[model samples]
Target chain A: MMKNSLMRNVPENYNPYVSSDDYKSKKRVLIDKKATNSTVEYLESYSDLFDKLNITDGMTLSFHHHLRNGDFVFNAVCQEIKNRGLKNMKLAPSSIFPNNQCLVELIESGAVTDIYTDYANGPVAECISKGKLKGEFLMHTHGGRPMVIESGAIKIDVAILGVPTVDKKGNGTGKIGKSACGSLGYAESDVTYAKKVVFVTDNLVDTLDDYQLDGKYCDYVLKVDAIGDPNGIVSGTTKITKDPVGLKIARMTAKLLDEFGVIKDGVSMQTGAGGTSLAVAHYVKNIMQERGIKGSFASGGITGYFTDMLEEGLFEELYDVQCFDLKAVQSTLKNTTHHVMSGSRYANCFDDNVVDKLDFVILGATEIDTSFNVNVTTDSHGKIMGGSGGHSDTAHGANITVITTNLIKSHMPIIKESVTTVTTPGADVDVLVTERGIAINPLRTDLIEKVKDSKLPIVTIEKLLETAHEITGVPQKIERSKEAVGYVVYRDGTVIDTIYKID
Target chain B: MKRGTAGTLESNDAMIMVKESDGLKITITSIVYDFFHEQIENVIRETLKEEGLTNVEVICNDKGALDYTIKARLLTAISRMEEEK
Candidate 1:
């Protein structure tokens, strides 16, 4: 009886339902056969493809924004959805441009209930600022986007990719067509994970061999008359300001660079694409040209002006997260020196990233308070106007952060007793430059002493504040609400500051 | 130095000439290039086609005029012609 019980208690080595070694080998062989037979489908139009895909409510949709102000596809697609009375759709766009102003209408119509993107500019940011979306707007760095997709945090349902050129097999390229905008780096993550990937192109090729995006992953292809304007593709050349007042500030910033002793060989720096910041770049370029110095690298939103410096041998390399203009895109495509950086590699502070190596960074500000807190969001009227696009990240990472702005814009003083909202911490900002003078943060006394002998205009932070107040009688204190409208996230995704609704 | 009186046009095309101020004499010529080259010429011709044979020659000093700006200037000049009569 004991022997009979032991035989009954013996466990089976494997179940029939579970795949054994032989079953696994057979499954792999089947997958290989299917892969070889896989073929791409071509649809007559965008609408036809959408109908076939059956894009339903609560579906996750994505868009690429290589065309900044010139983009029309995002708005067009959203408008179509709005007409169809779709609701609760999640927009997981790589980025949103100012030209996609129609997104505001979609938000009003409740078609887009949630948004996840690396950056938002123009009216979409305005709507988000007004707390219009049903769900929270989750912001991610470029690298963070791919990471989230890989982790299945953001599973894409339908990715509507805007291609400059595409093949019949659904292969796509953005560098050669009439509206060529360059590398499809941002769309790489979506194509990998999306359940259905659609390529919308103006120029359709006969074959898939020349396309940069692999047709093996793409499922459907659609053709249109025009994708976007080539001129609008590179709307701004990322030029430096040549204005007198701007030049003075640029020169002062260069002097500060000299004083801080970060102007030597193998140093790295970053600057914004704004006119004044670009002016600082030009001045820095002049300094490098004169001293026979070379920088290790430059990083951030790469522009033509910065690309020119990289090509001119001022810097050994350019780590570009996103190309802002045609020149930048061309250089990134042709030149080996220009390296493409993923968003996570660019500024995700949670991860050990490349921004930590930055020696200096020049930024622009809308208002600066006496305590050195900088505000890039909200105007004097407390209206939500701007975004914290990589502002807090650069300020926190760089050893020296210089802010440039005129003392007054349109007869209104920019220096206030307290900023409307603090986008960058007071501790991070080292210097503030105005057309009239320069203000060194008191916390950075060492920088002040270093530049004491320089001919560049230097003044105390208090003095600059006083001067601004003297011109335009001190601004009345703004009353803020306790209810938060939006949150300013630091590079590490921490809540740096919260915005209240405009009263 | 060549001297000429510059005039402002009223809504009814009445000319109000003013004396020139002293400064560096500079003339700025503006050329409006459309995204499509033909659109610009078509716009200029369509707006000015209706006006009668004109004696007043307008030296367009363009700094960088948008499509609307070009149309407005041409219309204003045509309206000024009515005042001359």
Candidate 2:
């Protein structure tokens, strides 16, 4: 066994991100001069663990959303912390979900005074949008999250994570047991960097067949009855969108990708779990299967569709950071080609990231303007709905970034005078594919020149905006509020845009 | 007076609930209420006026449906509310 940066006795086959690239040159990561906790202390309860750690105010406690909307650890721990009347504790979860609605109470009670997450929505988001979160509610990208964590920008006092299965030595994996939500990718850095790390598990086995996280970092283990509801841990199954307008937008996006030679052999791609984005993958899959073209790797939050491709040999491998559905979780258990990459390895800026190897990525937009600035961070009314999970990271890394959406929905046009908030800049955005037409960013003249001769309904941004107005009619402009709820940070760690609270 | 219902809650489709009342009263719940609530109310007013319908209550449950879909649903609901039973 060889020692890694965290001084874990990594198995011979264990692969770590030894070096990182900054686009031009590769730099080596620092090695551990000292060792971390090599023994795991098994605790039975969160309160006991909290007391053992001396739970205090103004502590940055963290968790991961691998359990998605079904997670129980975050809520249970928050309730305990609230029960203890702890004040001013900062939540540093990787992302927040509806199940994490318990955070709303914590926020209101002043138990959780600050929040630092990559994406969020539902009650906690609504509370944050209403300007109820007393402390700074800052948003970061998935990649930027790890960068800041390692840089000690966001100091985490304790990282209490849920692990599905644990070995006697405290090594954990999210791939087995009842609440197996695969790919403990998001929690990897948390376990490695936090001052104290705890793994709460429901299933204890003699040994793990494979592991994503090392045991050296784990200082405590709390065995519980369950970590989360299995049914709610991940999606039942993801299906391609059958929405007519969505299909049209997706078809246009696929055609544009094909016309631009993005569907060729050895191509690497990324797509979200959105129906329209899935439709684009469906269309592109048919083309790849028809031509018998094999690709390299598909990365990011993987779905069953991409796993099917891996099985069919359409792609060589899948670099999954998080599993979006149950099928993906199963694939991680059985498929040898399915590999898990840490969040930093996935898209951290100033590091060699998977997105840098991405040829194209299909993403959605809550709103887009003629300038190609895309906003997934808020609704049309400027309420906090989502932040750049990997939107800007993939956009910045991919050779081509495509935004797919209907020109108008419910009489509201997507292409407007300007976006409600800028989650990704126009420089990174390459093409906008709507059912009405497709618009290429003028910055990407190379793409424009290539697709100019194609039969795709390529149009200028202004024409698309005009068509949107014709269908949706001119909408009344809502006044932007003076108070800012929060700010969106780009992948490069810059404040791309500030979100205004909806009055 | 009998009640009539038409349309659906699907995206780009609005559900219309119509019934007999003392005077025309239209209440709308639209996803785009912030931007197009006034427009949706105007569409209902114009459609009911053109149909020469009076003493009725119209409720529109909108899910980002377009103006034409809303109008069609309202018209169908009006006919249903007036049909012989």
Candidate 3:
């Protein structure tokens, strides 16, 4: 009774209705007739929904990463599968955070053989780098993720949506609960396409309308006492290092902003949520305040810091794909100037996107070589570590991409003779900042000449590398296994680089 | 620099009247913003329960304390209160 053709001819502006052309189109696809009725099913617990759904091998399961490191749902569900002795189920998460270390155990148990995610960090990335998972790993941008789901390229059998707040009707919202994480945009596509959608929440309300996510799409609602740690949701918003060394780097970056003449009013900028990047924002804020300048917009993973800047009239608008703090959530909910953008709109290189309009973007790097090739993933040991996220897209799109970091970390020089893996090409990076000095990429001679007389210390890329080498000596090259554990795909879905297992 | 100089400084009620740290003043002034907002009471109750304390005062000169900062401030306030006799 389920129409297979309904998914094929979905209109440009399709609304969820049974009789509309869109509904008829969806009804034509009768793969499973029993699932057509959108009725509410009260599940006693998550385990009950898992049992009722009959999750089997080769079935695709999905999860969202709104909770970041504080999320316990993914690991909890995967643990249940491991306990049930399930195998070969593809794990398609919106993103994976560091706290989901239990996924390493699930991978070893053979319950999850394949993974498709926008980001992966910590032990899971390490495990994947070691070629631990049996199947291929695919990385998609936030925008591409929804596109893939909508196109039916990656069919999701069951989507386990972790709700910070949910009603009996399975409607959920992340903006108004104890674990409120803001917009449910990432899970919207999954709920629409998945054969069965399950709502897992720690906080359940008396009515469905209280939930922010549309309840019409959900099939079952299961409640738990505590869903995720509120602290972890905004864990990335810590203060950047105020060390004199970091301040010097930040000053150099700010000077670079001045020299590029991109420090004028109405310029748009984006920066990572790292300590050093946040430091750059702090410095930029001071310059803006001093110069009496206001920016046009700020974008990317928005934090309360950025929202406050917007609220304080520092920026005219904020384009947020995902909010990093509760202040951001409150701002997005209350302020009209704060806009929510899809991942594709945020950083999909295949599409004409907003990142292309950014005047400057301050990024963090684990290592950079003289070639200007950057590596945000892996370490000197070639161990699988970080994630690509929006690094490459933003680097390529931003008018001036400045990579700010200390010359050395933990006695290891960050400017290495050669980077372990190239996440962003050197051609895209405009400047590199060290505590000692700033290095302009050779391609930006105009920038080089413009800053010639600036008081900020300017040095050659080679000199910065030498400074790092002087302190740490030469680093030992890591021996890598021939087997590819995971691949870092550019925003266009091309294999930019691959990570191998460290022996 | 007597302990009792900054108010009646109890064991856990210590206060240091030092100069403000150098940085942006990310101030957050939250006073149950929407009184009739759904689950407003529940959020406050849950926040207190999650923080694991009874009574405390939080004075924050926010350089932009995000949601996490607000929660952290409350948590710090509660923990400071719990440490007292």
TM-score of only chain B in every candidate structure: 0.44, 0.95, 0.36
- Tens digit of lDDT per residue, candidate 3, span A259-361? 7798889989998877678778888898899989999999998888898899889999998877777788788778889887666567654445778899999
- After superposition, the stretches of candidate 1 with alpha carbons farther than 4 Å from their true spots are A1-41, A117-121, A127-132, A138-155, A166-173, A183-196, A204-219, A350-352, A442-449, A452-455, A480-483, B1-85
Q: Cα deviation in Å at residue B78, candidate 2?
A: 3.6
Please identify model 2 stretches exceeding 4 Å from their true place. A1-35, B1-5, B17-25, B52-57, B81-85
Tens-digit lDDT track of model 2 for A52-101: 98879999998999998889999999989888999999989998888887
Q: Order the candidates by DockQ, highest first — what do you get? A: 2, 1, 3
Clashes of 1: 4
Candidate 1 lDDT, A1-503, residue by residue in tens: 01111011111321111110112232111011112115677777656766889988888998877766676677768877877788889998877777878888877778888887766767887777777777656655454465566456677888888888887767777656777776566676677667778888888878755555677778887778777777777645777787787888788778778877989999899998888888888888888999999999999878899888888999999987667788887886677887765555666544455677899999888888887888876665544666566676677778888898878653356787777766666777888889888888888878878877887778887888888666544444545565555544433333445556553
lDDT of 1 by residue, B7-80 (tens): 23322112211112343122223222211124333434555465542233334444333345445666665555
lDDT of 2: 0.85
Candidate 2: pairs in clash:
A21-A352, A410-B64, B12-B65
